[model samples]
Target: MSWGVATLGAPTFLTIGLLLARDARSDHPFFWPSLLGIVALSNAVAILRVNQSHRRAAFARRSVLALCYLRAGMAAGCAMFVVLGWSTGALQEMVATLAEMLDASAPAIAIVMGTWSLALALALAFGLASFAHAGALHAWIAFRRGAPGPRPGA
Candidate 1:
């Protein structure tokens, strides 16, 4: 597995940890932010690999699959983080931030974050699954293209 795929494990583990350590009024945020940062950096590396023209032919199909899988993992991890964040008043913080930016109150902020998180989580799930499917399809195409020619008749 590429380093990009390998690094996704960190975010997944952090999200699991956050879920386990949920507290409504905790002062310190879980490692979720660092998890996000790590995933983002991994994706940046993958993007740079894809953008390198010299390496394009060297990794055409593999690169595409890696990128798709990376995106799927990233979306799934972030969605899971949001779900875990909601448990730790990060949801509240998110709402407060939005409300401050828009000049509103807590309840209004709750409604906004609640709805947005729900919609965004569902959308992320859908996108992640779709990207995974694309990666599978691409893999199948590559496999078929690389098959050995038919054997000669007896």
Candidate 2:
């Protein structure tokens, strides 16, 4: 099974979601719904991957599945926080901080704000995934390195 295919879809959706959601004009027909859908789908895939494998393959599968869940969950949650802020008027605070720059030059401000938001979203995704998989890193390596063998006493 190609783990990369399962892994790539979630982040791609999330990155696009966050970028689209950040726009002030974000009711752009596709942003918010896409974010929600991608998040739900990513979690579904993670759950499926974790449960689908046999016990003997569980150790190898667990790391990837766990990381996928962690990444999707954290990134989606953070992006949701930003959306919640938009809905609840907390985004006013963010806008206030950017007001001067935005007034002076809208494009630069947009670039800066968008980059900051997306960078943090990506960081949260990567950091949570790394932490979740850290303990299993060596186990995965050893599992792959060990020679094939019959069941003990079989």
lDDT (Cα, tens digit) per residue for candidate 1, span 69-90? 5565455555555555566666
lDDT per residue (tens digit) for residues 3-22 in model 2: 33333344445565566658
The TM-score, computed over Cα atoms with residue i paired to residue i, of candidate 2 is 0.33
TM of each candidate vs. truth: 0.38, 0.33
The parts of candidate 2 lying over 4 Å away from their true place are 1-63, 98-154
- Highest lDDT: which candidate? 1
Q: Which RMSD does model 1 reach against the true structure?
A: 10.7
Report the poorest 10 consecutive residues by lDDT, candidate 2.
Answer: 134-143
Candidate 1 lDDT score at position 36: 50
